[model samples]
Every structure is written in C-alpha cells, then in structure tokens.
Target: MAKAICILTGNHTAFGVVFFKSDANGCVTVKGEFTGLTPGKHGLHIHSFGDLTNGWISAGPHYNPNNEMHGAPQDEKRHAGDLGNVDVNEDGLAKLEMEIQHFHLTGIHSVIGRTLMIHQNEDDLGRAGNEESLATGNAGVGVAWGVIGICQSNISEKALEEKSNQ
Candidate 1:
C-alpha cells in the first residue's frame, strides 16, 4: 500500500507521499503550496519528533537520523530532515517539490511519526554565525505546523474484489 502525510504551515503547506518498496526501501515525495507569506525566503524542514499534546512544542529538532549537527539538505553532514528554504513571490506565495531518501512510512524511522514546520525566516545552512545560527540559526518561529500521518486509501477491499471478478 502507498501512504502519505499532509501538513499545513503558517506561510505554506505541503503534502508528502511515501511508497514502500520493502522493509528498508521506500521513496518520499513532497509538494508544497503557500500564500500570504512575508516575501523573500523561509526555512522549511521536518522535525524529529511529533507532539500530540502541543502542536507547537511537539515539533522537536531536525530529523537527524545520523546524529550529526544540522546542515542543508544537500550537505553531506546534514540531518535527514534538513530540506532548506522555500522562496515566496511578491504576492507571498510559493510552491515546492522534493524527493527524500533514508526515510520511511512505517517502522521506527517513519516520518509519519513526526511534524512538519515552516519558519518565518531563512536558513543560512547552519552558517549564519553565533549561537543563533547554530542549525540554521533557529531560523525564526514556526509560523505554521502540522503532524504527519498516513492517508487512507481510496480503493477498498470490496472494490478490488469486484474488479477481479469482472
């Protein structure tokens, strides 16, 4: 079965679909939609943990499956959840797409058990200088946040049985 998680942030929103090929193999694709942003760029990433109690606090640090410090998504020493920034037009809207590796839909490392966040500021790729810049400078507050979860499949068992009989 294919699964996905949808998240809505303050500045932008995203939908991620995860297809499992095996226990240890899978693909994650995400598309983001946003409007009414502050203009320029903003930091986007997946938090390590999920907060069922408080949506704001539930989002922990970046998803560092490798236990390394924070870095850009393309950086070799970066966290698994370090996706970098998203640019917003003058109208304050932006769209983005991404494909991720070393993440899963099920099991312990499953991204479905975490939170997605959109920050109000840009990420300097952890090189902004000073403690504030540590791990993208904490980038600004989370303007919007959402928990990840598997979407329900449209095809039901009954529907499949009928199609097979046909």
Candidate 2:
C-alpha cells in the first residue's frame, strides 16, 4: 500500500496531523487528528501546490486538475481536493476518518506533492447560492495548511516489491 503524511501548521495555536494510505483496491483512506480548533465544522481539502515559500496561500487553490466545480465529497462533480468537513468537539479536538476515490498516493493523480488545507468555516458544498460556494464551497479563509509528502513505511522494501507484483 502507498502512504503519505501531512503535518499542519499556521499562524495560530491549533495543530493537526493527517495520514493517507491506499489499499489494493485503489481506495485511499484519510485519517487525522487535530487540536485547538473552534467547536464546529471545518472544511478540509487538498490544495494544488505544496509551495510554502510565502505561507499557506502560496499553496494555491484546490487540487482541481479537471476544472470541476466545488462540491461535497460524495458529489460526482466535485473537485479532487473536496474531502468534505470534519467536526470539531467542544474540547477543540477533532478526529477524522474517511475513504476517498478521486485521489491516490501514487500514479499520475497522486496527491503526495500537494498541500492540505483547513478552512475557517464549514463548507457550504456549493449549495449556498453564491459564486464563492461554487468555486470554493465558501470554505472561508485557510486556518491551517500542510504539505503532503511520501511517508517512509515500516514495511520492508522486499514486501513492497512483492505487493506491487501481486
């Protein structure tokens, strides 16, 4: 299985770490944990670039190579970066787990070189009847962001080669 990781950072005290793993079936599982967040829904996505030379905004927009409109994770027309929302608890801690089909850890559509974006507000999923909604799900300003990188797994190189041949 292919794997990746993102360690979130920003101008605030909030922090987050996310993991991505791919199964043999081509589905990618996203798992993450966060702290110091406002109690509510927050939009989570994968931005286009991993550049952080000028901070989070330098990461660019959502990873929409296909030029699709912003929408929910289940929306067939949503951008590749649209992973929907993650709910934060009153204690300011959030745990996330989801399966996605639009992106992967390897291959041409790999997200390993992209960036993860956490928005300040809940994603309207393009149903807000506004242009911003259709473009960004109206996710508001990015509160935190991180670059996705290839993770060195504990699995031995021999095992990885064997799995790839199967």
Candidate 3:
C-alpha cells in the first residue's frame, strides 16, 4: 500500500539502494542491493534519526523504541530495528531481501523518517560476551548509511491512459 526508498552511501565510496514496502499481507518487505564494501559480512540496522548531517553519527543509536537489547533479526529479544547484516561477495556486492515484522508504518515502532546504517564489521548478533554487544551488537564502525523516507507515487497521465486501454 505504501513504499519507501533509501539511497545508501558511506565510507570508501560504499553505496547501495534499499526499498521498504508495505506488503499485501500486512508485513514490511525490504529489497535492495549494495556495493563498494569489503568482501564479507557487515552490520545493517535502522537508526533513530533521519538526519545525516554528521553522517552516521547524526543518526543516533539503533531504533529501540521498545527498549530491547541488540540481537539478531531472528532473535525474539532484539531491537525493533535490528536487521542483522548484509553479506558482501568477492566483488564487494551485496543483494539484500527480507521481510521483517519488527516495525510498521503506523505505530510507536514505525521506521518512517529514520535512517538505516551499514556497519564496517559483521554484527555478532548480540550473542557475543562483549560489553557493547547488547548495545551495538559488536558491529564495528558504520561504513555506509542512508536516510529512510516515504516513497512518493507519481503516475503519468499517459501511463494511466495506456493502462486503462490494456
């Protein structure tokens, strides 16, 4: 019913595109691809703020409106914004596709106007024994980030007419 898109960019010329859409089944579907990162796993999460003035730092901590500890996307105790990680291939390209019920467009946990971050290292899934694991998931510095925004639907009259004719 609604859609959102982000143009991700960050350290070492890292960049990617992501789309957040409200699926027909009342769930959110995330689909996108990223590149210009190291060949390995990297953290991915939705941040608190949408402002990118100071890059990733300005986005604030992971969106934890529910006051939950950091954990894997599949973990029942993880933050609402915890999206786990994106695995880059040998050429530093990552294609991401997932459906998560952690957030919604109409709720206190809504991700609208927030930002998504891509960390420099793999997220340990908050299973590690480190002190910050419960906070940052042991994910290293943010290498790339993007602001999430509601998508605008603009249809051309010509396209509408063509569709009607079909």
Candidate 4:
C-alpha cells in the first residue's frame, strides 16, 4: 500500500491533490481535483514517461503496459494509461476519480517516472480517423501537466496531524 500526491497549476487554472494508490498487482488508482477549468469535458491520461522536458512532448506515449494498440478507455484493445475523460461544471471546477489497473505507480512497471496530462478537449479515442489519433487522440493542446511522484503515506498522515494540531 503506497500513496502519491501532486499539485497541478497551469494557464488559467489551479488545482491540487492528484491522488494515487499502488495495488498489489501493480495497478494504480488515480484521483484528481481542480477548482478552475473551462466548464466542459476534458481529457485525462498518463503520458508515456515522467519527463516534462519540453512541455507536454516530454511525457511521450500512453502507459501501455501491455504494448496494446490505442483504443477507448473501456475498449479491450486500448492502452493501459487510458483512464478516459473528466467533466467540469459551470463553475469551472472538476473532481475526478478513477482506477487505473493496467499500470503501476511503483516498481519496475511503475508510472511514477511518468507525467499526467490534462487536455483542453475530449479524447475522441482514435475515432477521428488518423494514425496520430491512437497515440494522442487528436485531443487538442495540453492545458496542465504534472509530474507524478510517490508520496509516502506517512507524509500525508503527518500533514493531517499538523492540521488537526493547529
């Protein structure tokens, strides 16, 4: 049982708490929240590797642990990093929670060294008809990016304790 948390801030948006849970089988549960964003559906995914070198491009490919071809989140043939989209309300806020069982947040196949990207548009899931669609979903531009890090559970617990003490 391990935990990870990240705070993501970007153009016209600010948010905190991207929670992750590493399971026994090397899967991860990804949860995210945001206070501001365009009121609409937005795309979310685990980029290839954790290296925000040159903007979003540094993240590279989806977390396809099985080396499967691209497909929708629910599709059987899809990549491992496909967690699907998140919806934002009229207040430009979002609370996203989903389980990603195909990839790990720790160990050899971990996604820790990878980055999570929030796109400005919905992922058509390769329905747009193009080769690049499989890898990128033609999902417009990236609005926010955050490097995933493994946060020890004790750290979060201590923070909670400090808050209670205060």
> Which one wins by lDDT: 1 or 2?
2
What are the per-residue Cα lDDT tens digits for candidate 3 across 1-166?
Answer: 6677777887858988787777666699888788899999999999999998998899999999879889999888879889998999999899999998888765577788999999999999888987799899888888988888776546432343344336
By lDDT, is 2 or 4 better? 2
User: Which rank order by lDDT, best down to worst?
Assistant: 2, 3, 4, 1
TM-score of each: 0.75, 0.91, 0.89, 0.83
Which is better, 2 or 3, measured by lDDT?
Answer: 2
Off by over 4 Å in 1: 9-25, 154-166
For model 4 the TM-score comes to 0.83
Off by over 4 Å in 3: 153-166
Flag clash pairs in model 2: none
lDDT of 1 by residue, 50-126 (tens): 77366556677878787876777777787777778888888777877776665667777778768777787888778
Candidate 3 TM-score versus the reference: 0.89
What does each candidate score in C-alpha RMSD? Answer: 6.8, 6.0, 5.5, 3.3
- In angstroms, give how far residue 107 of model 1 lies from its true place: 2.8
Candidate 4 residue-wise lDDT, 1-166, digit = tens: 8887665655656454578877776666667677667888877877877777687777787778788766677787888777677788999889887766666766666777677878888888877778878776767777887777778676664473344336
- Candidate 2 per-residue C-alpha lDDT over 54-162 given as tens digits, one digit per residue, 9 for 90 to 100: 8778988899978999999998998999999989999989999999999989998899989998889999998999899998888888888889988777764345434
Off by over 4 Å in 4: 12-16, 25-27, 155-166
Pairs with backbone N, CA or C atoms under 3 Å apart (clashes), candidate 4: 49-114, 50-113, 50-114
